[model samples]
Target: AQSVTQLDSQVPVFEEAPVELRCNYSSSVSVYLFWYVQYPNQGLQLLLKYLSGSTLVKGINGFEAEFNKSQTSFHLRKPSVHISDTAEYFCAVEVSTNAGKSTFGDGTTLTVKP
Candidate 1:
């Protein structure tokens, strides 16, 4: 089984500041990592993923993550963040196989203030 852990339950950042969301996973076999964001009352949207190929993966909303197999970590980062970026972020993991289902972290609430 695969599981995800988000180091921080909440992150506070000022507008235009850089931010990083820590994500770690545990799996016996190769797995896929994903970062998702959910706005208030909105559905979760994929931010980034690491399935194969390059260890570094980029996704929507200026977010990027590096897949570290040795560390079993896939940390999400954005050089600059906007007020609109305030939302709940989740780290998820699934086995590499198509039959795998994602296991999500508790989620990190990103609050951007002026």
Candidate 2:
């Protein structure tokens, strides 16, 4: 079994400033981690994922995340954020044995101020 936790429920930042959304996971088995963004009234969009290979993973909209097995964390970061970046972000964990099943965190709402 696996569980995910998004440390912050809301993160407000000024436009063009760097931002980081913290995510942590707990699992007994190997798991795949993913970051997703949800715009208001829109479906979720894949931001980044960490299944294997390098610990660092990059995704759309100039976002990136580093998977740290030691810390059981996969934190997302963007050097510069825009007003358009304002959205709800989620962290998910999928056990390797369970291909499509995933456990998602509550979500972190990022509000970008212009």
Candidate 3:
């Protein structure tokens, strides 16, 4: 089984501001990086992923991340944020080459104050 440390339980950000979510993981074999966003009482939506390509990967909603192999870190970042971006973010690590199992971070709630 794999594990992930979110580092921060919550992150408060103002409207139209920039934000970054910290994430660290521990694994013996290769792992997949993922960030998911969840609105109030909603399911998680894929923000971005770093599988096996470039270190820098971008996703929907102007979000991007860089996969660091040595540090075992995959941090999520966005230049600007909106009030609508207020949600709970989770960093997950997928283990198993074929059968993927997700181990998610506690959560980082981005409070985009209006």
Residue-pair clashes per prediction, in order, are 0, 0, 0
Q: What clash count does candidate 3 reach?
A: 0
lDDT of each: 0.93, 0.96, 0.90
Candidate scoring better on TM-score of 2 and 3: 2
Expressed as tens digits, the lDDT of each residue in 1-114 for candidate 3 is: 688999888889887889998999999889888999999999999999988979999999999999998998999999999888889999999886636568999988888897
In candidate 3, what residue range of length 10 has the lowest lDDT sum? 94-103
Highest TM-score: give the candidate number.
Answer: 2
Model 2 Cα lDDT, one tens digit per residue, 39-69: 9999998998998999999999999999999
Residues 17-91, candidate 1, lDDT per residue (tens digit)?
999999999999989888999999999999988999999999998999999999999999999999999999999
Against the true structure, candidate 1 has what lDDT? 0.93
| TM-score of every model versus the real structure | 0.96, 0.97, 0.93
Runs of candidate 1 exceeding 4 Å displacement: none
- Model 1 RMSD in Å is 1.1
Q: What is the C-alpha RMSD of each candidate to the true structure, in Å?
A: 1.1, 0.8, 1.3
Q: Rank the candidates by TM-score, best first.
A: 2, 1, 3
